[model samples]
Target chain A: MYEFDYRRPNTLDEALEALRTAPDGKLLAGGQTLLPTLKQRLANPSDLIDLAHIQDLKGISVEGDTLVIGAMTRHAEVATSPDVRARIPALAELAGDIGDRQVRNRGTIGGSIANNDPAADYPAACLGLNATITTDRREIGADDFFTDLFETALVEDEVVVAVRFPVPVRAAYMKFKNPASRYAIVGVFVAQNSDGVRVAVTGAGASGVFRVPEMEAALAADFATGAIEGIAVPQDDLNSDIHASAEYRAHLVGVMARRAVAACG
Target chain B: MTVTVSMTVNGEVVSGEVEPRTLLVQFLRDQLRLTGTHIGCDTSQCGACVVHVDGVSVKSCTMLAVQAENAAITTIEGLADGERLHPMQEAFRENHGLQCGYCTPGMVMSAIDLVRDRPDITEDEIRKGIDGNLCRCTGYHNIVKSIKAGAQAMKG
Candidate 1:
C-alpha cells in the first residue's frame, strides 16, 4: 500500500472539514472495500478520513413507518439487530447473507451502497424497498441515488449519513450466488407494500441494480410466484461473465424473482 | 507518513510507530513479533489472517494498523492460557481438525467467535459460518466436528 495521511475524526463536522482540506481524501467507513482497493494500488488517496470514531453515524431505529439505519452500522450489526429483524426481516436476511462472517463484521451499508458494486446485495434492498438515502448534504431517493455501474448520485466529499427504508407488508430476497465469493450472480428482491409490488434485480444488470416493471405489475396484480412465471426479463442489458452468461443471468432473474416472492410468505 | 498506533493485543497494551499503509497483520508479525497469526492469502478471501477486533472476527490483512488504534485485539497467540490451550484449540487438537495446519489459527479463531455467538450452532450452520476460512487440505469434516465439540466444552 502507498503512504497516505490518516485522520481519525470524532465528529461528522470534523470529518467533513478534513475532506474539504484534503482534495484527494477518501472516507473510511469500515475499510472493507477501500482498504482492499488501497492494497491493490487501485486507488491512491492523499488522505483517509476515518469515520469509525463518529458516534452519530451508527445505529438502527424506527421512526413512524420507516426503518432508519445509520450508514456506518456494520453488516453484522444489521444482521443481528432486533429492531431491523422485527421491522424488515428481508433486509436483515440480506445483510446476514452478504460476503462472509468476517467480511460482514467489517463491511458497512454506506460503503456497500456508495461503492455500488453491481453484485452487492444492499443496492437490491434499497431499490426494491424504495429507500431514501440521507447524506450529509441532502437526501436522495433510492431510484435516483444509483446512477450507473460503480456510481451514485453522491458527489465528491459527500458522506452518506443514513438510509431510511419503509417497512413493507411482505418482502424477501433470493440470489443465485457465486459459490466461491458468495457474490450474487443473479439476485432479486421482491416487496409488496401499500403503494404496490416492486421487483428489483441486481448482479444481472449491465448498468447496475434495476427494477422489473413488468414483473412488478404482474406481482402487484396477483402477489404470487406464478404471477411472474412466464414474464421474460430482456437479455440485452444483463451482465455476462465466466460465472454466468447474459442469457443465463436473464433466466436466473426470473427464477430468483419467483423464489423471492415465494420466500416472502 | 508514519503514525503511532496503540492497541491492546491479547491482554497487553502495546504501541508502535508504523507507516500509515502498514497492515494490521504486518504490524503483528513484524513489529510485535507475534507470528502465530499466519497470512494465507494476502487478499481478504482467505481467513488465515483472522483475529478479534473488539471481540469480532475480522481479516487483519485488509485492515490498516492505524485503524486498530485503541481497539482490543485477540490473535492466535492470545487464545491459550499459560500452558492449557483454549477449549477450541484443544478440540481441534483432539479431533485432528487439520492436515498441514496452514489455516488452523484463523479457523480456530473464526470457530470460537461463531460458537460464542451461537452456542447451539448446528452442523449446517458451522459449515456456512466458516466460509471465510479455507483449508487447502479440504479437511472441513474434522474441522466441523472440532467446532461442535468445542462449543460443548465451552459450556462447561
Candidate 2:
C-alpha cells in the first residue's frame, strides 16, 4: 500500500469531480477487494475517491416491475430488504450467501459487479436476470456491461449510479463454493423472465462469466431440472487449478444449473 | 501523503494523523492503543480485525482509516461494562469457545453483530453467520455453542 491521496466525496457530483481531477484515481466502495489488492501491492493508484459518504448512492426501491438498487447499497441491506425478499427472493438469497455476515455488512452489489471478479456472485445475477446498469451518463445492459475478466464497459471516470433488476418470474442462483476463500468454484444462475429462460455461469469460464444458450433453450422448453439433463458445458476453456479441475468445473456447472432450476420450483 | 481522520470509537471521538494507506485496524491498534482487534491476515481473508463501522461488522484491515472518517466505530473493547464481560465474552468463557484465543476478539465482535442482526437465528444460521471469522485453533464447535448461548443471554 503506497502512500496516496484520499478523497471522501459526499455527493456523486463531488465524486465525479474528484475522479476527473485524478485521472488514475480508484473508487472506494466497501474496500472488500480494492483495499486487499492494495495491501498485497497488486495495484498502486495515485488517488482514492471514497464513495462511502454519498448518501444518494444508497437505497433500495421498486420502480414498476424493476428493482432499482442504488450502487452503494450494502449487501446486508439487499439481503434483508423486504422489497428484495418479496419481489426477488433468489436475488436476496444470493446476496445473503455472498462472502459472510461481516463481509455482507460492508460489501455492495455495485462494487461486486463493477469489480467484475470472475468468481464473484453478483455478475451472475446481473447477467442472468438481465439487469440494467445505470451510470452517470447512460444505462448499459448487463450483457454489454461486462466485457472481460476484471473489466467492464465503463469508461474512464464513469460512475455507476444503480442497477435495475427486472423482476423475474422465477430465478435462483446456486454455487459450488471454494471452502477456504468462499469464492464460487462454479456458480450457475437460472432465471425465468418474461423475455425467456436465461442461464449464466461464473467461476468456470476462462473468459469470465458467460451465458449458456443451450441450457437456456432446454429450460425454455421444460421449466424443470430434468430439462437440462445430460447437458454439459465444454471443459476445454474452463479454469483448472488446485481447487478444482476444468472437467470438474464443467460437471459442477451442470449440477449447479440443475439444482438452481429445481430450487426455483 | 498524510491525512487527518476523526471518528467516534467506543463512544469517544478520536482523531489521528496517518498515511492515506493506513488501515482502520492499524489506526485502532497502533494509534488509539486498542489492541483487542487482531490482524491475522493482510489479504482480508481472516476476520481477526472485524469491527463495527457505523453499527455494521466489517473487516477493519480491509478499510482505510481515511474511509472511516466521521463514522461510528465499535471495537471489542466497547462491548462490555468496565469490569463485567459482555454476554458473548461470558458465553465464550463458560463454553471454552477458544483455545489459543488469537481470534477471540474478532470472533466475539462478529458474533455480536450476527446476533444483533438476527436474534432468533437457528443453529445452522449461527454457523453460517460467523463464516467470515476463522479460528485456526479449530475450536468452532464450542464457539457455535457460545454464540447460541450468548444470543439467548442477550435476550434475557
Per-model B-chain TM-score: 0.97, 0.96
Question: Could you list the CA RMSD of all candidates, in the order they appear?
Answer: 0.8, 1.2
**Superposed model 1: Cα runs more than 4 Å off:** none
Q: TM-score of model 2's chain A, to 2 decimals? A: 0.98
User: For candidate 1, lDDT tens digit of each residue in A1-265?
Assistant: 7879999999999999999999699999888889988888999999999999898999999999999999999999999999989989999999999999999999999999999999999999999999999999899999999999999999987999999999999999998899998999998999998799899989999999999999999998898889899999889999989999999999999899999999998
RMSD of 1: 0.8
Cα DockQ of the candidate 2 complex: 0.89
| Backbone clashes counted, model 2 | 0
Sort candidate 1 into its docking category: high
- Worst window of 10 by summed lDDT in candidate 2 chain A: A97-106
Pairs with backbone N, CA or C atoms under 3 Å apart (clashes), candidate 1:
none
Q: Write the per-residue lDDT of candidate 1 for residues B1-156, one digit (tens) a residue.
A: 588999999999999999989999999999999998999885699899999999999999989899999999999999899999999999999999999999999999999999994668899999999999999895699999999999998988
For model 1 chain A, give the 10-residue run with minimal summed lDDT: A30-39
What is the alpha-carbon interface RMSD for each candidate?
0.8, 1.0
Global Cα lDDT for candidate 2: 0.92
Chain A TM per candidate, in order of listing: 0.99, 0.98
All candidates: TM-score: 0.99, 0.98
